[model samples]
Target: MDDVVRRTALPGRSQSPHDKLARGLGYFSIALGVAEMVAPKAICKAAGVEGIENVVRGYGAREIATGAAILTSHNPEPWIWTRVAGDLADIATIATGLRQDNNSKGRSALTLAALAAVTIVDLACANGLNSEKASRKTAARDYSGRSGFPQGLQAARGAARDFKVPDDMRTPELLRPWT
Candidate 1:
């Protein structure tokens, strides 16, 4: 996008396809995390990955945290980047399973492909968010001629010197420190 168009007023940049994508991905992460955490054994069996329930659960926790941050933050850019980082970690972990001797090699490959797809989406979303610009221009007004006090500084300083405290606002006699 051109710099001029990017630097538009607030409403113009409020909603975009990238924002919706980010939100969708957030919900997807939470759902996937829940399933992974709740049924690690089932996931492992389905994914053909065995004996890694604990690792799966840990990744699930990471996913949930990343998703929550993405959903709750005013700016989800950093959270999305976190997701990208997590994706890389997941890819690395799954790649180890791609060894020829691994019984679940086929499933692992499939999972890696899916992860790659999601990572692409994450990268695109992160890039979109990074490029988004805010062009809100503050109005320039001259306040130099005005003073908070109507009188000059010296007179204003003592203007409230004789002011009396209202009974309602004063400390109770019982709690007073001095007679």
Candidate 2:
């Protein structure tokens, strides 16, 4: 998106300690993303996906939200809250698109879902449910396991890297997918 739109769409890019903290996560995101891009085999093994890594690398808010639903509906962790928040935001965004007059219902739904993902993340962090660092780290760790989802963590990391997600977006402290 254009700078103006990106700046306008979300919260201000203030340089407070909080913003700095979020940027700090970017390193983690980058590492994961890089690992996924560079070494899918090792990452998949670490995370447990003979084929799961490719599927996970394709994740967006919708996928994360679905995972959250499964977690909440069945097996939840304290860390699951982070995914929940992200999912909610994705839903909210989809809702927003549905409300717009000119947008296609389908297109709006997708956009709304994406928006919801980011917004849920914003809410979660803002509400003290989780700090950005803790939340992202938890997400990285939980998602990194190869058993359930293989390449996803790596994919997320790669996405962050491709987008040049700031440090806050990376979350590098989490263990790497491969050694």
Candidate 3:
């Protein structure tokens, strides 16, 4: 015989799923960009896209910019969309390696596949961000009518006029004269 399992509701989340994904992707972008900048030739060899060292370095710079922007922006949706565009650009550039002249079609294909996957993630994150933004816009409340005080202004003023401190509370014995 097996014991019954108990189920519980999940606690509140500090970040939305899209935000978490975006943060992870931002870090990944910076790391990959650094690798591309530091060793463009190695990256090209791995992807089977040779003779584009300068282009790879430029892409690396672009990646770093987008990643930094995403991490620092107050509203990251636009930055995430920027990453999606970057992915498309990368996919387009890598597809060139599929040419008949390039012998490493397998590696290029693999690279393209990976880019496609990343692009999908970016698209999802961007769409989620947009949804969140739309919901926020619709959910805004008007707090302008609120007065911080619980009582109305006139009442508060009247109470203050009649205010009196209790004897014990007015001065603690500890801070009194030592006589």
CA deviation > 4 Å runs, candidate 2 = 1-13, 59-179
What's each prediction's TM-score?
Answer: 0.66, 0.28, 0.71
Prediction-by-prediction clash tally: 0, 29, 0
For residue 71, give model 2's deviation from the true position in Å. 29
| Candidate 3 lDDT tens digits, 51-128 | 999999999999998889888765678989999999999999999999848689999999999999999999999998
lDDT score of model 2? 0.42
| Over 4 Å off, model 3 | 1-14, 137-179
- Predicted structure 2, TM vs. truth: 0.28
Which lDDT tens digits does candidate 2 get at residues 14-130? 343444333432333344445555665564444322444554353342343444443233112233444455446435433544555652566655555554655555444444423
- What lDDT tens digits, residue by residue, belong to model 1 across residues 1-179? 34333333343234667777888889988998998899998887766677889999999999998899888875677999999999999888777777647678889889889999999999999988777633223212334545677675666776677998867566776787774
lDDT of 2 at 113: 55
Question: What lDDT does the true structure give each of the candidates?
Answer: 0.78, 0.42, 0.80
Worst 10-residue lDDT window for candidate 3 reads 1-10
Q: TM-score order of candidates, best first?
A: 3, 1, 2
Backbone clash total, candidate 2 = 29
Alpha carbon lDDT at 95, candidate 3: 92
